[model samples]
Target: MHNEGKTKMIPFGDLSREYDDLSIEIDNTVAGLLKSGWFVLGKKVEEFEEVFADFIGKEVFAVGVGSGTEALHLALVASGVTHGDYVITVPNTAVPTVSAISFSGATPLFVDIDPDTYNIDTNKLRELVVIEKKRRGNKLKALIPVHLYGQSADMEPVLAIAREFNLTVIEDACQAHGAEYKGKRVGSFGDYACFSFYPSKNLGAYGDGGMITTKTPEQAHTLKMLRNYGQEKRYYHTIKGFNSRLDELQAAILLTKIKYLDTWNTRRRDIADFYNQNIKNKAITKPVEVSYGKHVFHLYVIRHPERDRLQAYLQNNDVQTVIHYPLSIHLQEAYKDLGYSQGDFPVAEKVAEEILSLPIFPQLRDKEAETVAELINSFS
Candidate 1:
C-alpha cells in the first residue's frame, strides 16, 4: 500500500504514538498525582490494584509490584518455593521468567513447548513431572506456565498436572493482559498470575511496573508485606521483604490506560487479521489461534525456514521486524549451570531459529500492515 517511489519505514512498535493518543488524559492524571505530593504506594496504587484485581476475575486480589520478575519471585516465595526446590517452566520464554525462578533460590527446570501453540506442552510437562518426582521427591515446588504471545497455555491440563504432582501453579502472564482461556481470563487460573506493564506491553505503563493476582486473601496480605519491607503497619517488620512497591505515578498512568486496554487489544487483533488474510506467501507460516480462547495477539509472529534471509529482505525494504527470541533460555550462557545441553529442548530451539515478530500495535495503520505483508510476500 506504500508508494512505489518512496518506501515507508514501519517500526516494530511505536510507544510514542500510544502516548500521543492518550497524552491529555495521561498528562492530566500525572499532573493530578504531582499535585498530591505522595509518590509511592499511595491512593492511585491501591485504586489500580483494586480495579485490576476485579478485571482478572471474581474474588481475585492484585498486588502491584516493581516489575514482572519481582511479581513472579514474590509469588514463588509466598508459595514457599525456596532453596533446593525445583520449579518447572518452558525454555522458550523471555529470560525474566527463568530469572524470577532463580531469584527465589529455586532451581529452574525446562520442558519443551508445543510446536503449534508455542506453549508448554502438557504431555511433556506431565512426563517430566513424573520423572522429577521419582528422582527428586517433594523437591519440585512450583510450575510456572508462561502464556507466551498472549495465548493461554491450555490451562485445563496444566492445572490438572499441577494438582496431580502437588506443585503450586504460577501463571507468567507478562505478555497476556486481557487474554482468556475457555472464556475465563488468564490471570484467574493459576494460584498466582504475574503481569508486566513495561513500555511496550499490550497494557503497558510509562515505565516498569508489574502485578500479581491471587485468589487467597492470606496470600494477598503476605504479598503486600513482602513488597514493602515486610511491614504490616508503618515500620513494623514481620518478615524479610524487598523494596518492590509499585509507585503512585505509574499506577495513575495505568489507571488511565486500563480503560482502553480492551480497545487497544481489539485493534491489535484487527491488524493480525489483516496480516493473516493478506500475507499469501506459502513458505511463511502464520500464527494460529487456539479453539478454546481469545488471543490478544500481543506479538503477531510468523515463521519461515529462511528466517534470516526474510528478515534481511524486510529490513532492506524498510519494513522493520524482530525475533521474539533468538535463543532459548536453556541454550543461553547464563543458564548453562542448569545443566541443559544443546539439544535439551529441540522444539523450542527450532522455533527460536524460525520465529519473527512483525509489527502489531493499536496505532499501526491498516495500510502499514498490508505493506508489511506485501513485503514479506515478495521475499524469496
Candidate 2:
C-alpha cells in the first residue's frame, strides 16, 4: 500500500529496474557477444530471426533490420510500393509510420481511427479505398494497419478489404509485440508485418532494432538483400539497397529478452485490469479492449476533457504522465505539404487532445498503479 502522506516521484517509464532485474543474464550474454568478435549480421542475428519466426508461428520468415522504420520501408519495397504510389495508414501514429512511407517512395494517405478501439476504422478504410481507387485509378498500392497501443486492429475486415482491392497489407505491429486477433498473432495476419524493438517497446532491445515477418520466400529474400546494401552474397550487389542491417549486439540482447516477452505482457495486462476495475471518474474515459483481440496495454491511456490539467495535477502529485501523441502526424509541421487540416480526422484529433499515457510498464508496482488511480479519482 502506498502512504498517501509520503509522496515520491513516479516516472512515466523507468527502464533501470527492468535492467537491474536482468543484469546478471544480460551482462553475461553481452560479454559473450563482445568476446566473439563477430558483430553486424552474424550468427546471433540469424539465430534470433529463426527463434522469432517460430515465435510468430505459421512458418513465417523473420528478417532483422536496423529499426522499425526500416522494417516498414523494406516491407513496402518488397511489396512493390514505388514512386508516385500511395500507401494507406491511419494518421494517429508515430511520425515514423508516415516517414517510412515516404522513404519507400510512396505518398502516405491518411485514414481516421475507430474512437473506441483507437485503431483504424476498417469500415471507413474500405470506403476510402474504394473511393480513392475510383478517383485516382490504382495509385493506392498498400495498406499499413497499425496495431496501436498493444491492441490488434480488427484485422478480418481489413484483410478482406485488402483482398478485394488487390492491395498489399502491412501489419504495423511495432507496439503490439504479442497481441492476438481471433487467437492468431497480429504479425501473421498481413502480407508483411513490421515490429520495433526500441528500448520502450513491449519487446525492446537496448538500442534500435526491428523485424519483418512474411510468408513468401521471395519477399524474405528481397528484404534481406534490401537491408544489406542489395547484396545477398558479399560484394555481389543484386539491386540498389540500404545499409539497414540489425547488428549482432541488439540481436543478442533481444534473444535474451524475447524469452520473457509473454511474461511481461501478462503483467502489463494485470496492471491494466487493476486500472480498469478502479478509476471510475466520469471526467476520464478508459481505453476499451475489443472483443476480437487481446490488448497488451503498451500504454494505459485514459482520456479527460481537461487532459492537460489532469497531467499537471498528476505531475504536482509526484506522478509523471505523457500524451501518447500530442499531435496527429498529418497535422505535424513536416507533413504540411500533404495539405491536411484540423477537421480531417475528428476522432484522432479528439484523441490527440484527450489522451494521457499513464505509467504502466511491467516493472511498475501495483501500489504505484493504485496511487495513480487514486490521484485521478481525487482530481477535481
**Candidate 2 C-alpha lDDT tens digits along 290-333:** 88899999989999999999999999889999887999998999
Task: Give me the runs in candidate 1 sitting further than 4 Å from their true place.
Answer: 1-6
State the lDDT at 3 in candidate 2.
Answer: 70
Which residue pairs in candidate 2 have backbone atoms (N, alpha carbon, C) closer than 3 angstroms, thus clashing?
Answer: none
Among all windows of 10 consecutive residues in model 2, the one with the lowest summed lDDT is 1-10
Clashes of each: 0, 0
Residue 201 of model 1, lDDT score: 94
